[model samples]
Every structure is written in C-alpha cells, then in structure tokens.
Target: MGRQYAVIGTGAIGGFYGACLQKAGLDVHFLLRRDYDYVKEHGLAISSTFGDFTLPQVNAYNQVENMPPCDVVLIALKTTQNHLLPHLLPPLLKPGTVVITLQNGLGVEPEIATIVGETAQVLGGLCFVCSNKIGLGQIHHLDYGQIQLGAYGNNHQPQGITPTMRQIAADFEQANIPIQLAENLLLARWKKLVWNIPYNGLSVVLDATTDAMMKDSYGYQLSEQLMREVIAGAAGYGLEIKESFIQKMLDYTMKMKPYRTSMKIDYDCHRPLEVEAMFGNPMRAAQAVGVAVPQITMLYQQLKFLDARNIAIGN
Candidate 1:
C-alpha cells in the first residue's frame, strides 16, 4: 500500500502537482470547487515544459467529507480563502497526516498549525513554478517547476531537515518534480518574497510581464531596489540573504518566458489580490524590527488600493 494523497485546492499548483503524482502511479485525490464536475467527468489536461499529458480518470471530489483520509494533504488554496480551512481540513485528517501548504507569503504554517493542532505535521512548501489554470480542468505550465520544502518551527525558527521532509521529497522525486529541503523555513519564505514581491506586485501595477519589466531600464532598476529592500528586511530577522541573490532572481526573470504573475492574473480577473500575504505581512514584519522598507511599503499601499478598487468595480 502506498501513501494516499489529498489535494485540497486543485488550481494551478494542486492540479499540476497532483496530476503529476497520479500520473506516476501515486494515489492522488483532488478536491475541487468550480472545476470538480468538469474534471470528474472529463479528467485533467496538463500542458507543461516538461511534457504534455492527461489524466483520464482522477479521484476527484467536490467535498472533503466524501474523500478518504490520506497520508499527505496538499493545501494549494489562495491565502485569502484560508478562512474556509477550518471546515474543509478536519474531515481529511486522521492520525499523523502531513499537511503541506503550497502557498505564498508568511505566517501560513502558523495558521495551519492552529487548525490541525497537534494532530498533524505542518510543513511549508515554497513553489517556484510559473503555472496557471488556463481553463476548467486545464493547467498551463510556463517555466521553472521546483519546490522547496521546510518544516515549520516554533516562533518561525529553523527546524532543519527532518525525516518527514525527506519522505515527502521522495514522493515528489518519484513523480519527476524537483524538490529541495530547507534547513530554515523562515529564511526560505523571505527568500521567495525576494522574487515574488517585485515580480508579482510590479506586474500588476505596471501592467506588464517579466520580460517587459526586465527589459525596461526604469522597471529593471526599480526591481533591483525593491529586491534590496526585501534583503534588508530579512536581515532584521537575522536572516542573511546575499546581495548576489538579487542578480540571480533578475537573471532568472530575464530568461523566463513572458508570463503574467498569479497576483497580476487575480487583479485582471477582478479577483482579490494577495496583497496582505505577499506585501502587507512582509512590510509589517520588517517594521516590527524597526527595519524601514519604504519602497515595499509604497508598493503594498498601491496594491491595496488597486486590489480594493478592482474588486469593488468588478472589473
């Protein structure tokens, strides 16, 4: 008997990864919202840089109560929908279930820890993939599909690599998805923000993609400046993010395919942007330690205003 997996939100992250796991012969059950009926009947289609494939039959469910308890549960929902976790998670928990949150921004694991309490192991998965749900039951993978897994610690300290992390890594590796285990989850979260903050936010505000931003002089310099501020903010928590990492991120974006960020997509769709998770929380964290992130603060304010107006106008 192999490990049974449950994907809580089968959007881009969950749908792509869960489909990969299932294609590799792993038992992956997907819990969907809007796409449940379509996927349940027609299955999932994935077009990726690695290759294109389809799952003709998926263990799809619309409600968690109808799904079986699994060894691993992947939560891929937007942080904004986290309020529903209390109702959606309990039914899928048995003993010793490993709940990995494939969400962006800070304070995710802590919130999950409170929900599951001591009943399950909490891990944070920082996904570095550029994917989007192009249509119902369809996911388009643009570039860079790798995940870094770290165990959540008390007060967001370093937990080091653990057996559970290795166990889950093996599962993903078997599915041909790249995995890296982090010694410090907090540091990894901040490191992800170094890329996410500038790219995701600026994509919406500037109404451009990565290529547009990287190619223009103003966009490029502003991105570098924001990256530096994020690096400085991380230092307030005693986390060392090397100056060279900024160039690495910039270089990565330069080579990536022209792509709209998840935040930008949300904004364009009139959906709520993850302003708080990606920007608000990071800015407040920096301010807590007296680290001033004026640029990040300004970006955060811009995003909040834009996000609210976009939703209110329904456009």
Candidate 2:
C-alpha cells in the first residue's frame, strides 16, 4: 500500500509539499480551511514563473471531523497556532504517524514532542520557498523552492523520525520538488532560522525587502549585527558556522528580487505576526546558552510592542 499522507494546514509550504506528493501518486489528503472549497471543486492551481497547471479534483477537507487517518501528517501552520495544539492536534494522530513541522525556528522539536509525545515521530523540515496564497485555491510561487528535511532523531539518541524519513524524502523527490535529507538537521534548522529571525521581522517592521534592507546602510548594518549574534548563539550551542558562510547567506537573500516576506504579509493583512516562533524561540535559545543577542532581543521587543500596541488600539 502507498503511504497515506495528510497535509495539515495547507498553506504555501504544506500545499507545495502535498502537491508534490500528490503528483508523485501518494495517497494524499489536504486538511485545509474554507478557502480550499475551490480546491475541492476545481483542484489546486500552482502558478510559477516556470509554468502554471491545475491539479484537478484534489481532495480537501474544511474541517478536521471530516478527515481520515493519515500515515504521515505534514504540519505547515504558522507558529501562532502552536498554543492551540492540545485542542487541535491530538485527534489527528494514528498509532505510527509522524508529524512533520515546516516552521522555521529554533527549539520547536522539543515543544512539539511534548505536545505529541516524547516517542512520537516528529520530523523537522526547512522550506526555502517564496510563495503566496494568491486566491482561494491558488498558490502563486514567486521564487525559490527547495527543501531540507531529516529525521529529528539520531541513530541511537533519537527524538523524531521513525525509519520512514528516507522513504518520505524519496517520495517527495519523485514529486519533482528538490528535497534533501540531512544527517544533521540542527545545522539546517539553525541555518534557516538565521535567515528568518532577523530579515522577516525587519521587513515587516520597516516595510522593506531583502535588497532594500541590504541597500540601506543602517538596515544592512543591523542585519549583519543581528546575524553575527545569531551565529554566535549557534556556536554557544556547538553549531560552528563560519562567519564567511553566514555572510554568503545574507548576500544571497539580499540579492533576491524584491519580495515581501511572510512577516510583511502578516503585517499588511493585520494578522498577528508569528513573533514567538520566528524570533522569540531563537532569542530565548541564545539567552539559555548565555549568548548575548542584544540586537535581536531589541528587534523582538519592538515587534512585540507593535503587536501589543496594535491589539490595544484594535488595529
């Protein structure tokens, strides 16, 4: 029997992965919000610079009650939904199902494991894609679609990923998305986190893009300062990423086409920013390791203030 895949929170990352799996001929179901009604009626529309195609008659569920048990659950919800886990997630797991988290942050595995179970298989994946929910059933791909996933567990001291990580990666690869299985996933998580933590927040707070921020002398300096601190925080936890490699990452993101990040999108929509997962988690980790993160801490603080003020003023 082919693996039963349930794509939870069918946003850009989940939709993209589930679409790939569906293309690969996996038994996939999308548990989405009401916006996917059109997807169920007309299937999913993926519009990319490469091309556009509609996957006709794809399965979509508006409510969890209508969903069936799945072998693997890919979770792509924003980190803002993390607190609601106890109420929203328990019923979705089968005996041996693994829930993969594609949220970019530090120290998420532990929190997810605590909610699901210590022995529950929880794979962590990093999505390097720029996409937007263009319509009810359409996802507009802007640029960059790459994935880095690995068993959050080790050969002996395992926490996430059963024996199925390789199979999952293989299935996703067959779906035509570039997917890589990493032996050391923490490095990837930290790597991705380094990019997201500062840029995403800064973009929304300042209404800037990767290039705009890099071009503006003050913003560019702030990015470097915050990123260097993040790199130090990683090393404090024994992730020895070189300064040069970190600069390369910043340069890549800076050179990307003018793109408003997820944070900027949220700010524009008046939705709550995922301040906790994207910024709070990493800054907390740095504090735990006694790594000074003054710049990031300040950014996080200001962002939190923005949210708090907005909520208070009903904006």
Best model per lDDT: 1
> Which regions of candidate 2 deviate over 4 angstroms?
154-163, 311-315
Clashes of 2: 0
User: What does the lDDT read for residue 4 in candidate 2?
Assistant: 85
Give a tens-digit lDDT track for model 2, residues 1-315: 688888878877788778767877888889877666678888888887536677887888877767777778788888887776665567677788787888777666667777778535878888888888877778887887877876765321333444577777877777777777766677677777678877888987788888889888898887888778888888877877888976897788777887788887877777788888778878888899799888889889999988777656655
Displacement of the residue 3 alpha carbon in candidate 2, Å? 1.1
TM-score to true structure, per model: 0.97, 0.92
Model 2 global lDDT (CA atoms, 0 to 1): 0.77
- Cα RMSD (Å) per model? 1.2, 2.5
Task: Please report, as a residue range, the 10-residue window in candidate 1 with the lowest summed lDDT.
Answer: 252-261
Q: Candidates' lDDT values, in order?
A: 0.94, 0.77
Which of the numbered candidates is closest to the native, going by highest TM-score? 1
